[model samples]
Target: MIRVQARTEQSRLMTFASPLLAIVLTLIFGSILFTALGKDPLQALHVLLIMPLSDAYNVSEMLVKMGPLLLCAVGLSLCYRANLWNIGAEGQLLAGALGGSAVALAFGDSESMWVLPVTLLGGIASGMAWSAIPTYLKLKFNSNLILTTIMLNYIALYLLIWAVHGPLRDPMGFGFPESALFSDAALLPVLSDSGRVHLGVVFAVLAALVAWFILSKSHLGFKIRVYGADEPAATYAGFNANGISWFVMLFAGALAGLAGVAEVAGPIGQLTPNVSPGYGYSAIIVAYLGRLHPAGAIVSAVFLAILYMGGDLAQIEMGIPIAVVGMFQGVLLFFLLACDFFIRYRLVSSRETVA
Candidate 1:
């Protein structure tokens, strides 16, 4: 018989190696999936992985996608480090977009430089406000946050749908479910003259830096680590768990909301029913794949961004289903979890004596 036993001490080496192993496994499984779909695996792999890095324009687009993922993932890392499960980043993002859009629409005629800053603030506030619901419930009623957050995501989506179709609908869009284009002052400045990359990329990098600082150097960060490691120990140390929850949830919501505003004001240029293609959800995978570390999440976000670009490339150039991208993400996460499990436990042979 084979038995699984917990390690006496966790493997520090595996902590770094697991993500790489997960990537390799994901690639192997992805190749098999391509072959099963009746495609040349090597060619498909080239399209999905290699081709995205072949050109400058593609690289820029990948960076553009990376911005939101990085922001959301870094925020989520903070929450996870504090043992706070915040699953409604998607809803918070939508709420932020709506709030920012409302500002843009109201100040559509403004030429002031402050418009942009104010819009971003509106987004952050809205996101924090949305996340506050779950936090409040958990604090006041001892409700489960996971269920509330997930349910809030659907509610936010529906609200976005309604907004685009009714109140925020563009009059000149031929009846499309979209808002008007933001004013020039409301839009984010492009990073380069040729590419769609915007200032949001810089924001994402700054966010990662801030997250690293907080997690590594701050007293509050020390408390969060202690709280996550052992709740009772944290309580005995006189740490306020509820305060930590509020801080993390609100902070995470702010970052996610900023990502939402960036999408509308940078790339999309307007609010729409399809403001996001599951960036918030994908960021969850990014956070874990990066070991819930801020710096690691930056790299993971870039990798996931490549997958997103590759998905579109495969669809257009190789006739592969776009769903394959999502499949790859799911497979990568599955492998990551498996790797983590093995890192914490080992399989050993059990000797049985005849009874």
Candidate 2:
């Protein structure tokens, strides 16, 4: 028999090594998976990982994908640091998109410079309002935030679908479940001529930098760290738990909302029934893989964005299932958890245990 034992002290090196180890394990798993699927594992790996960055266009697309992942992950990093498990970034994102689209639609053909900014503001407010509901439930009624946020994700999705099919549907488009294309005045500026990269990328980077500053340097960050580390200590120090929760959740909602609106106003240019390929869900993995650091999340976001483009490339080149991308993300998360577990504990053999 084997016994699990906690180490007296965690290894500092493991903090950084765990994600790398997890990636190695994920790659090994992917190799086996590809072999079992009757595909060449090496070729599949190349297609899934290397090819996405082989061209300028794909690189630009990866950055486009990175914007939302980074934005969502940065916000999530803050919430996790505060010991709040907010799981409704996806819903908040959808709410933002819906809200922004509504504002954009109201603009019709107006060329006012305020169109874009107002639309983005609408989206941010929408996202904040969406997140506020669950935050309120958790604070006032002591409800399970995890459950409430998860449920809201579905609610938001369905609500967006309803809006697209009902009120927001484009009348000139033969009944498609989508809003009308946003006018140029309401859209994000393109960053490059070669790809769909847009101003959203700048917003994501700025958000990450701001978040890093907040987490590492600010008084609020200290309060958040203290609150997460020891609630009793925080209470003794007169830190308001409810206030911190509200702040982090609202901030997260705003960033996620920005991401949602950016998508429609940038690459998509319209409110579609499918506005995201699950960027919000994927950001959870990026957040953890980055050790819950905003800066680290940027790196992880870049890696995940590669996988996003690679998933499309694999489907087109190797006839691989698009679901493989989701599988890879799930596998990576599992491995990361396993690696983290090992980093904090050790296994004792039967003889060692007996001794």
Candidate 3:
């Protein structure tokens, strides 16, 4: 017989090294998997990893992909820190894109600077409203967050599809399921003349910085930590658990909304049925890989963004499906969770324990 035993004390070194170990293990597993598929593992891994950073142009593209990831991850890290388990960042992001596009379209051909900010705020507000529903259900009716949020993701996707097909459809493009091109003032500014990198990257990094300060430097952060650590104790100590939940959820929604709007307003240049290639969903792995730390999300986001670049390269160069890239993410997350489990507990024989 076997039993799982909790460690007497946490492994500080493991806490820092677990993600590293997981990455190494994932690489090894990936190599074996590629070989089994009759592909040269070294070549496969090269295209998936090294080739994405082999050129300046590719690097710029990677940064573009990283923007939404970093933005979404920062918000998720905070919500996870509060133990809120809000899984609707994807929905909030979609809502933001939808909301921001509505505002941008409403402005028509006008080139006013205010168009950008107002459109962005509309996106943020939409995200907040999207999050409010699940938060309300959880607090008021004790609904399961995972289910509600997951359901909302599908709802959000269908709604976007409906909008682009019916209301926001481009009237001039012969009925394409897309909105009209946003004006110059409604778009994010490019960071440089050389590539598509834009102001969204700056927003993502600034969000991480702000989140770090909130989690590490504020009185509210302390209360959040306490509430997450022990709800009964937090209640006894007069911390408002409900307020913390609302704040974290809303904050997460705002950032995710910004990510959604920024995608259309920055790179894609218009709203569509697919504003994201699953950045909000991917950010969940990124949050845990970062160990729920704001700064850590930056590193994880960059790595995942590289994976996105490499996935495209791999499909073009090696005939690998893009689905494989998502599989890698799922595997990496599984390994990270397994490594984290070992860091906190160990298995022992029941006979040994009895003795």
Candidate 4:
């Protein structure tokens, strides 16, 4: 007979190794997926992982893609650590893009560099405002934040669509559902001439550093962790859970908003329905894969961005389905989550358990 047992000491090594293990498992799953699709698995793997970094242009493009992921992941890390289930980063992102685009379109003619900062501020404010709704509902009416935040996503999306169809629509765009082209002053400065990479990459890296500092070094971060780990204990110790929720949600929303600002100000150059190709949703995967740690999330963000870049490459080279890219990411996240289960629990052999 076999008996299950809990170890006196948790597997500390597994905690650190889970992400790497998940990555390896993802690669294996990807190979199987490609092979099942009748594609050359080795070639697909090479193109997906190795070839993208082989050229300078692709490297820059990778950075461009990584920027938003990094920014959003940083904010989400804070919220997850604080036990605030703010699942509306997608809505917050749209709100930010809409707000930032308003600033850019209104001041597109001005040669002032202040437009960028103004746009960023507008985006952040909009994001925080959007987040405040669920925060307020959760705190006051005792509503479930999870459902409210998720539903708000559709509301924000429709608002964006309405803007493009009406007010933000370019008069000379000939019925195109997009705003006018942003002026040079409204755009982020390019890091390289050939690639679409911009200064937003630097902003993303800085955001990660800020997140690390806040979560690791700040007293507020300690409070957040305490509250998250044990709510009853936190309440007994005098920490206000509502206040913590508000702070974490606002911070996360602000960061996601900054990512929205960066997307329009850097790459897309105007507000459109395609402002985000699921970057907001994808950042959740980045957040968890990074173990809800700022530095880890940054690394995970870069890796996920590579998947985006690699997907494009694979599409061109092998004619693989675009769906495959999402599948790969899903596999990675699924494996990561599964690996985490082993960190606190492990399978025991029958002889060892019986003994």
Candidate 5:
């Protein structure tokens, strides 16, 4: 029989090794999934991992997809570190798009270059405002944030659907459910000629660096770490858990919102019903896969971005469903969590008993 041996102190070696193990496991299963689909596993793996890196154009596209992922992951790291489960990033992202589009459509043509900044701010504020509801409920009524945040995402999605279909829909768009295209000044400038890589990458990178600094170096970061490690100890040390909760949710929501705006203003350049293909949700995986570290999140974000690109590639090359991509992501998360078992406990084998 296999038994788990709990360690006195969590093994730091296993802590880091787990992600590596997870990747290996994911690859093993992914190959199986591809083969089960009647596709060449090696070719699928090559397209999923290698093809993206081979072309400069694809590289730029990967960076474009990575931008919002990094942004959302950075914010999520804060909330995770503080032990605050704010899972409404998807809804928060939509709220940001709605708010930013409202601003951009209203004043995109104005002579003031301030429209872009104001739009960005509006998006961030919208995301924060949406997040605050659950935060307040959790703090005051002791509500389950997990349930509230998830329900809020659906609400946000319906709200966006309503706006695009009813109020915010472009009048001259031939009845399409989308806002008008943004002005040149309202759009984020492209970083290169080959693809849609834009200034959002810079923002995402900066957000990661800032998150790293705060979580690793600052006093508030220390408080958050303490609170995550031990709430009683944090309270004993004079840290207000409620305050930290609010800050973490707001900050995370803001970053997620900013990512939404970046997606619209940089690549899409307009509000649509489908502003994201679950970027916010995938970011949850990014946070854990990165082990809740900003630097690690960056790496994971890029890796996930490749998965996104690979999904498209697979669809084109192998007639694979897009769900295959999501399956890959799910497999990564599942294996990563399974690998986490080795961090604090080791497996041992003993005699098997017949039932």
Candidate 6:
């Protein structure tokens, strides 16, 4: 007979090894998927993985996607670490973009250097404001944060749609649901004239460093870890649970908001109905894949960014469906979860000598 049993102690080595195993499993499953679809598995894999890193321009584009993913994932990591489920980051991101767009539209012709800073601040503030809704509900009514946050995403999306279609619509855009192009001074500075990469990449790296410091070397981080590990112990230790909840939610919202503004200022340069291709949602996966560590998130963000670029490349070159990207993400998450389970439990075999 074979059975599974819990480990006497957590496997320290497997804690780090699980992610690698998950990657290997994901690749195997992906190849099987390609074969099942009647496609050339090797060629499909090449287009989905290798083609995106084959040249300078592709690399630059991949980095462009990486910036937002890294920023949002780092923020999500903080919230996850504290056991705060702020799943409405997508909503917070939209709120940030909306706030920044309001500023950009107001300063349509200004060449002031301060416009960019003010716009970023506006985004950050708006994100926090949006997050406050769920925070308040959780505190006052003891509401379920997961449902509130997830539902808030739709509210934010519709609010964005309404803003672009009604108040912020560009007159010259022929009824399109988009705002006017932002002034040059309001846009993020470009890193290279030949490519789309921008200064936001610098911000992403800095945010990761800051996150590492906060989570690893700060008193607040210690409290957060304690809270996550044992709520009753945290309460006994005099750590405020409500304070941690509020702080993490706001902090996560701020970073997500910054990511939203960076997307518009760095790449799109305008307020549109679609400011994100689900970066906020995808960041959740990046956060978990990185094991909720700041440095890990940076690396995972790059990997996820490559997946984004590769998905597009595959669709264009191999004629694969765009939905494959989501499938790949789901597969990766599933495998990671399975690996985590194995890390905590082991299969054992036992037999009777003469049953």
**Which candidate ranks first by lDDT, i.e. highest?**
2
TM-scores of all candidate predictions against the true structure: 0.95, 0.96, 0.95, 0.96, 0.96, 0.96
lDDT (10s digit) by residue, model 4, range 1-355: 4445566777888877999999999999889988998999999999898877888899899889899888888888888887887788888988999999999899959989798889888888988889899999999999898899889988999999999999999999999999998888888889997789998899889989988888889988889999988989999999878889998899888888888888898988888889888888888899999889989988898899888899989999999877777888888889988888777787777887656
Question: Per-residue CA lDDT of candidate 1, range 1-355, in tens?
Answer: 8788788988888888999999999999988888898999999888888887888888888889999999889989999998888888889988888888888878877999999999988888988998999999998999998999999989988998998898888888899999989999999999876669999899999999998898899998888889998999999999999988998899889999999888898899899888888888999999999899999999999999999999999999989989888888999999999999878887776762222
**Candidate 4 ranges beyond 4 A from true positions:** 1-4, 353-355
Residue 332 lDDT, candidate 1, scale 0-100: 93
User: What TM-score does candidate 6 reach?
Assistant: 0.96
Judged by whole-model lDDT over C-alpha atoms, candidate 5 comes out at: 0.89
**Candidate 6 residue-wise lDDT at 181:** 94
Report how far off residue 345 is in candidate 1 (Å): 2.5
* Model 3 vs. true fold: TM: 0.95
What C-alpha lDDT do the candidate models reach, one value each? 0.90, 0.93, 0.91, 0.88, 0.89, 0.89
Candidate 2, which ten residues in sequence have the lowest lDDT sum? 7-16
In candidate 2, what are the lDDT values of residues 35-121, reduced to their tens digit?
999999999999988998898888889999999999889989999998899988899999999999999999999999999999999
**Superior candidate under lDDT, 2 versus 3:** 2
What local lDDT score does residue 74 receive in model 5, on the 0 to 100 scale?
Answer: 88
Q: Could you give candidate 3's per-residue lDDT for residues 244-302 as a string of tens digits?
A: 99999999999999999998898989988879999989999889999889999999999
Instruction: Please give the lDDT score at residue 58 for candidate 1.
Output: 85
lDDT-wise, the better of 4 and 6 is 6
lDDT, residue 55, candidate 1: 84
- Name the runs in model 1 displaced over 4 angstroms: 1-5, 347-355
Residues 192-295 of candidate 5 have per-residue lDDT tens digits of: 98989999899899999999998999998899899998999999989988888888899998998898888888899999999989988999999999999999
